[model samples]
Target chain A: MIHPFQSVASNSDGSLLFFVIKNSILVYSVKDSNDEFKLVGEWSDEADSTAIIKEKVTKEQQRQLAENTAKKLKANDGTALPQEHKEAKIPKPGQGAPPIYQYIRNVKLSRDGKWLFACTDSDKAIVMFEISAEDKNNCLRLAKRQRLPKRPNAITTTIDDKQLIVADKFGDLYSFGVNDDQPCVNPEPILGHVSLLTDVAIGLDSNGKQLVFTSDRDEHIRITHFPQSFIIDKWLFGHKEFISTMCLPVWAPELLFSAGGESSIFSWNWQTGELLDRFNIAELIQPFLTENHLAPDRFQNKEGNLIEYSVSKIVTFDSLPLIAFFIEATKAIFTCQINRDSGKIALKQVLEVPYNVVSLACAETTGELIATLDNQNSHDKNFVAFISMDVDKFHINQSKQQKFDDFINSRLSDNEIANIEQEGIYPLYHVASLRKRGEH
Target chain B: MRAGMSLDDPSSRRQSYRAKKEENRKELKHVKIDAEVVAEKVELPKKRYYRQRAHSNPFSDHQLEYPLSPNDMDWRKLYPYFYDESKGDMTKEVTIADIGCGFGGLLIDLSPAFPDKLILGMEIRVQVTNYVEDRIIALRANNVKTNAYQNINVLRGNAMKFLPNFFHQAQLEKMFFCFPDPHFKQRKHKARIITNTLLSEYAYVLKEGGIIYTITDVLDLHEWMAKHLTEHPLFERLSQEWEDQDECVKIMRHATEEGKKVERKKGDKYVACFKRLPTPEII
Candidate 1:
């Protein structure tokens, strides 16, 4: 079996495209003439596969970490420390479960195209790469791998691009310097939520004050004052289900589009808590809601109905009022046009494809959408397709981009392909699991 | 009412007992109606019939129904006296929350103290929540002339999850976590009510200068709660002198059922209060 691309992202100009396979991140530079992709650079996880970073924990650092833990537990209370802390037990990374193999989660490229970050489940660390600003030949360079307290669920940068904020599955938010190379030793979280955090983004208010927006599995969308995350500005409590994907359009910074287990996408004015509109797509997406979207036998409803499908990816075009989004495990991509004057979102087009689209990235300069797909069913094993806007609708031009397939196929060896097949593949559709089931 | 009567089928026996108790309650309400009394005196629900296990897994997806958001929440049914039908909104919003309110003793006590403020109790169990609901109804009916218990209500909800759905930011002034489950095991520490993560959420709903009151009989859990609250960036511990002067602290120490149980057993009770400080400005 040919493993599908897990996720994809692109740089600001859309010249460099990044694809995440099982254990490696491949970078392909886009050609302006033929609109083809050239294999540029690749970084795999084989360099450092251990749970911790390559840098060994020095004795001084370990002792200091223990002391800090003790001080934190006994901050203002006059009472003595607890029995466990009295013994000075070293803190573990992830407490409850044992270690297991996991695939690379996703990749993110910075706005300036100078930094690239990806979280690896195998090591529970954020792998950072420094993109050479002037050198096109040497595109990606491994910079640092900082281990986190838990597995990261979402990653983004601060508005100023000085710090990288990572939200983990344990609902803690930690930030590190974007260019910092030192390993973090038991760093404390800056902010947190009680439920599992799914997505996080940042925007500015009317006064240009930075604000952070975080959504969780508990249907809460919180707008908090940045840096002072303790001071929550407002709570956008519109979603009744888990929110997995959130998009903040550059053209419309005042608006936010969020979707997950619900059939509709909710547009909101981030500055205030006012909801602009809720664009329901149930009728348009019903055809793609196949039996594969049904919940498992143990979790099926009494009537064996299909489970609520989750929205996977939502991206807004840079220069236009267009937004594209797709449902998890579906073959169709839906685009909507935003009327900024009235704050109304109208469905523009629905472009259907042969295979399931894994993720999407927009090239801001060229106004083209790059989509990675699960191409195991395809006879030629093509893994990507590019779409561009035609007049008022999105047109998929798959035949012109077929030349890029030869380069991708030649990069992977037959043995490596068989190895992936034997070990199975990572879950391509995971947004559905964000939905809370009846069973504990 | 024997503890173990296997021959009778436990579920059926319990069902019959519930039916009998319900009938008895109805009789007490209607049996003493007088022409002078405009409203019938409703009997309070019995505590023993509503006993349940003390622990509930916070992560489990319990069968719960909540509003899509705070705007969608219908508070008219919960507090009929506070609803202003002409304005299509409540006269006053709920400013006090009693999280994991077992038996709702604090809510009943606070009702008379803050007569104008709306107080809500959130419980996760079915029977326990029902008992609190019945208790509130009986108290309201008995004091209809004065409207003493008109501001207190109870709802079944997992406070750890979807708390934002029922409340907006800076909406609450006081929150009570009285005698929460200890979750003694080491691995279950995350399940405790007071954690670093949950404190941020509690702080979100609470306004600046808001107070969080906690009382428990378990020493370990008390220390854990105090430690986490003290370590949070948004909370500062109140001094002993401050706690001694606050009226809510005095009521919390003696108003909870767990406190009364500890008193009867001559056990110790630890109390800690924290004030939500203003968010610090980044230099």
Candidate 2:
């Protein structure tokens, strides 16, 4: 109930739910027709070295935090402004006793399902777990876990599975070799971002060079060379709000879907940086609010309420690039299918739920969406919710997909289309921050 | 319809008319009472065309009664069955809503059926809304045997605009749209109860698995309601089994004043129902 799962992952079949709860990654068999979550066993680091590293990292980070606070107090020695600011903006510290223990931020399975990458929250480490699917008794065995100079905000393996890219919250990206002859006890830093990096994804560009797509809090989506992340590529800059999530749909690797906590969802071509299509959800979500009698103003942010609805998480099904997104406050999860060919992405359906979701994942083999939901009480108990999208229900016939292919042909004027595809990179328009008349 | 009077039943209607006359007689006492004065003053109060305001805040009188938050609301008054939380052992809140309740027919019919649930009706017209209020008050007053009509209440509200002011997100399980005013003119299309603009608000109050029941005799309006609801991203047209098997549909088809009049005239009644779908990840 109280921080049961920091991160969760589903095996392709969705039968095994592997999540980082409390100290270890526990596996539960959640097969059909059964609510009984039979705990298989906890997947441990199985190394004395991990314990020593965790101890060393926690002591070091705690010392650094204390020094920073002391330095801040010394800077404000001559004034009461610091005290006034502290009094005005001291949010209830729900963080609860500054994590004396190490916690996991994310757990992702490789495309081939042979390895698991578990990223630490503040211990600045990425623990690699090798899982053999064939082994029933002990499928999960920790291979190696390495500490980094900075904690990773996002982590993902490349398509070819040779390199692992990790993005830190302090705004830097580093690539580590999967099979480096000499293991790096402390992974060296590589490229950097000026703002806090929210997410990083790996995909091949037109020339098949590994391009790392990174999204940040400053509304910038940058495409950079994989190993040589310092070599700047084109920037996809259009989001008016903080871009918290970014994903390259496995089915449509050429397209990158990015969403802030806004009502609009954007997808642009990664190679050309041309924003292929933009889906506005204001009309769709407004009715939902009214029907449920929920005040829209409650979700409005301080920045003039333009970005009221926030996408807490985005998980995509590998089958059709059918993506699942959640609005944490409203506890609403919606799925939409993006037709790369048509340049039209329509919201497909909404999943029924009554719990606040902290994380979302789509089961690899089952095509079902799994959510780690909060029970909407002071206790903050958690339970997993699942919805299966039977393949037959979504019949993606060629004719229907072809009908929407000529969208820009009919919808956009000659000048508008020219403006979009100028020099092959379409300007990603900001839906929430559209300039008013005579505002230039 | 006379304010605080029953129009469907002429027997109970004259009480209000007589009371109005009595009040007029008392006003005559302030001046001079004459036979000629009674003749002119006895007729209905002038040519009664409702003066429609541009923005109708119909629930003005009930503003003090409205709670700022759902938790602050005194639901015990609505659901008498669960007067005390610890004593009544009530587990679920009232999740059903009836929009534009004309004569309290649907409320009286559905109240006992869903005894554990709380149901609310919203009518815009002051007099019509008052009549329904009086009707429920009378029914509950005489309920010494079954304690019926304890789970329902009526209020004057422009539900389309102020819905968010009342319920929280996904608070409603079922919403009834029976014989809503057909703002037929193209210009007044926005004034119609159902529209793309209002549906999103409806989706917010209704839970992921909620259903919206719409019944109308007007074929054009029916088509319009059905078209807009089906085209909405959050709702899907409910299956035939749901429409046929649902008990709420039966009450909606036969319980309202419009439904009774439509039946008397042998008019065709078109019904469309859509389920609020769960998010796509929910499958």
Candidate 3:
């Protein structure tokens, strides 16, 4: 599934979530008690929309605000007052909203969440927005905009947020500075691929000095060192299909989860090209159903055709895999969890979304707050929605864990158990059984 | 007689002194002439003054007369000069360039070879150039052409400078450098045409690698041409590959008057052929 308007970010407190909406960057605060997130601002490139009016107001309002404050003087009561004998007043909330971008392909927030970066394939440039701490609803101050050499296919920022690396459709890798006031300069080209580069991810390697970039053309993920020296330390290749998305495991920097276009996910050692484990989620969920599959009644066309889809994000909740994928043709969201050590997958349930969701991202800290953006939604209204998962209720639904464990224990003989233990296969079977019973 | 033989006779002393000086001059002149004769005899064969039938021609018993004047000689008028009257035979025709062709004597002598090929005498001297031109016109030798270039040509002009321009690259096929002026000087190296640079240029103008034949009475000049031409990048010393390829060397040996001269002298002639290599791609 292709998602043109999606925003992926890790919050300041290490909480990761992404919004797949059109106009505004929805920052989901997963760790904070306030499950609510402030929309920084929304802008659109459409000619007839109110976004253009908002742009004019924001620019003119900022100028007026600065003029009014400059004329302020001390009053008789020792309070600051305007020199023209007028009161200096702060603008009301949401009064001069900034214009939201129209077609956002991908968005990334800084590690501190103070800076927001958004890319639009339509414009072929990445625009940056600075978040204000004083007011959450206030429009994010437009800091800078960097135009890439080609249209960006995927973008990811480094851990320190000092460098932003973007991979374009022509397989050219571009990087820009985050703190620069002018347009970012000096694009460094990364080599190794001869085809279109569809996706890129930046994460610390085992040594924490090299940056790894994954391309869709092949399974080889190139690891490049920081700074301007042209050197490739290693390449990791094991998967047979194009790598759709990759995420650095929160618990282990050495481990990375990559999902392929073949509807399979693999857990690989970042330093070594070892395929620790891999599982096809689509194959595992086919047998458990009563042949009464979820009807295609949810799609806009509603033709009873099975939609083939690939996983987009693989996050873990309490060591259980929480994978997010989109149904083909229909932009509905679905979540499934697989055990890493066991290679078991359970197709839990699918979420009913109002619009076609182009992208998905979940918070890394708690995996509780999940945000999604739909392609059809308007800039300001309902482009992004945050879903709060109830962990207690999820655990309560997995009451069959103990029952499955007992059944497996009763069926295994002493000799069989000893042989299975020797081969290190017992734990995998146990986890598989538990997964079949909806237990983590 | 007793008075004439007096010790203090000034007239006798004067006469004796004059006679002694005359004898010494005569002795010096004879020594010089003897040396010249020895050098010429040792370097050139007497049979060079009379040419014989070429090695390849079996049917014709034509013979060549040496030192034919540049005038009154044409390939068509071969009766008395090249044709053997007793056998009624005429020599075969061939083209040749007379190098250092002073007044075109060699060119005139080799005109019998010109029925099939033209004979040209390249001169580098102004007066000698005029003399050769007048001689060719006066002889009405249609097959013979002479040019006044300087010091290196038949009368004058550097043969090395104009040879490439006069002939297409590799057109001449066979070149004869006979009795080339040996500019013997340690410091005048640039004036020598047989240097490394000139050899490379020669190789360039030669065909698919053709050969350059050098003959000089001066042993040093012959060695110089051999060493430098062989060492040039585009040329290699002709090896066994030249043994069976008799056509190129045939003309050099029997078709030119100079070749006959070398053969008659019984001089140990040094002959070397440097094959031009194919043009190399510029780096």
Candidate 4:
């Protein structure tokens, strides 16, 4: 099986690109006018893989034993389950976890293009790297690997790029100095939500007051004061499903677009928490709903025919006032144009590709949308395609396309490819799993 | 033998279990109908029929329904007396919230104490929540002349996940946490009601000088709650003298079912109170 990029991101000038495959990060620099990718850097964790697997087996056995005892006892009142509660173990980051635990959840680049940030589930830590393109062989240099108390789901930097804010699965947001070397032992969070935070962003209000926006699994978008995060400003509360991704358009700073488990994208005025428009895509994407969209067996009801969808990525172009988003496990990407004065979105076009998209990125300077594909079915090894943004025509045309040919795929050893074939590709479509079907 | 025909077959057992669950649902509905729809002087729901487990997993989706925002919530269904339909708004909003309000003992005690303010009890369990609803209905029916219980109501909600969906910013004046689940295990500490992160959410819905009332039978859990509340930047711990003088604190001590049980056993009861402070200015 071929490995699809779990995440993709680009820098300010679109000169550098970042992709995550399993636990490692691959960096590529767009070479020249023709738009070819050159492998510039690579980074991987140093933990012993064999030891990690062995420890996982022991932990699994213990968990099964405890579960069996609890099941047999039928202790719903909890008073008769003292034995189970007494021996409950403290949670550790990397102990006895699944394969997703070893994969990097997300990767981010600084606005200045001088720094890169990535979070991994292995050690529950965020790794920062210094990017120096002048060094041909080694563009990324390890800066720091600061371990957090919980597994981070999303990360972003402040407007000044001086502070890194991390949102974790445990519903806490912690901010650390970008250059601080402190130990960060038992640090308290600056803000928190009662639900799992899926994404975090920083934006400025109309008066230039800095604010932080966070979305959670419970379909809430909370906006809080920047440095004084304890002071919550307001909540954008029209979404009825878990919000997985949010985009703050640079062209219209006051306009916010959000999408998640629901089949529609909502545009909002972030300052006033007023919903400007809801662009429904259920009818347009009806053909894209496949058997894979069905709810899992555990979550299925008597009918067992429930289908769900979630947006995987939402991007905005700097050269044009357009928003483009891709739904998980779908073969097409949707684009829309924003009316600047009213903050309303109108559907512009849908660009259908050959394969399902794994992730998407907007190249700031080139005015191109880069989409990574799940190319397991095809013999083609080229995994990324760049689509041109016809800004003058107000269209994202797929006819003018360029395939990104990089050395990363051809360079993977046969043994590594065979190993990936046996273990299967890392989960490329995970947004739909965030939907709640009300099952335990 | 055929697959589902055997007595010990898994399918047979599942069928019987589902049948029993359906029957249980019908009976619960009947109980609700008797309390709210048919009776003018309703009988209080029996506690034995509504018994359930003490703890529920906070992370699981419990099939709950909530409004998109505070504006979309229809308070008329819960508190018809306070809503003026012509105006399309409530005469007064819910100013007090009792989180994880098991059996609604505190709600009943505090209703007459603050007669002008609307109080709401939010519980997560299905059976326990139904019992509280039925109890409130019966009380209202029995006191129709004076309209005593019109200001109090019970809402089934996961307060941890949807508190802001039900209340606006600075809409609540007093919040209570009476005998919350201890979640004794170290890994389950995140599920506790009081933490550094959740305090910010609590502060968001509370007024500048709103009071948080807490009481528990477990010393460890009491200390844990106190420490987190005290360490929060927006909350200041009220001294013991203040707690003694506060009327709501005294009402909270003996007004909860858990408190009465602890008193019957002669166990220790710990109390803590904190006042929500003004947010500090950004430097």
lDDT of 1 by residue, A144-250 (tens): 88888678888889877888888888777888888776867778787777678898898887778888888888888877777877667777877878899888888
Residues A210-231 of candidate 2: C-alpha lDDT, one tens digit per residue: 8778886655687766564533
For candidate 1, give the lDDT of residue B84: 78
TM-score of chain B of each: 0.89, 0.75, 0.50, 0.87
Write one digit per residue (lDDT tens) for candidate 4, span B1-283: 5533544445556555445544644443222233344445667866655666788888778889889899888887787778786998889999999999999999999999999999999999876887787788668767766778788888778888899999999999999999999998767888898877778889999999999999999999999999999988899999999999999998899999999999999999999999999978753
DockQ of every candidate: 0.43, 0.01, 0.01, 0.51
CA displacement after TM-score superposition, residue A309 of candidate 1 (Å): 1.8
Tens-place lDDT digits, model 4, residues A196-306: 889999998877878899999999999999888878888999888999999887788888999998888999988877899998999988888799888788767789887
The runs of at least 3 residues in candidate 4 whose Cα sits more than 4 Å from the true structure, single-residue gaps closed, are A49-101, A297-306, A391-403, A406-419, B1-41, B85-88
RMSD of 3: 36.8
Q: Which candidate comes out best when scored by DockQ?
A: 4
lDDT tens digits, residues B66-96, model 1? 8888778888878878877798888999999
Chain A TM-score of model 2 comes to 0.70
Report residue A47 deviation for candidate 3 (angstroms). Answer: 11
- Which ten residues in a row are the worst by lDDT in model 4 chain B? B26-35
lDDT of each: 0.80, 0.64, 0.48, 0.80
Score every model by TM-score: 0.86, 0.45, 0.40, 0.86
Name the 10 consecutive residues with the lowest summed lDDT in model 3 chain A. Answer: A428-437
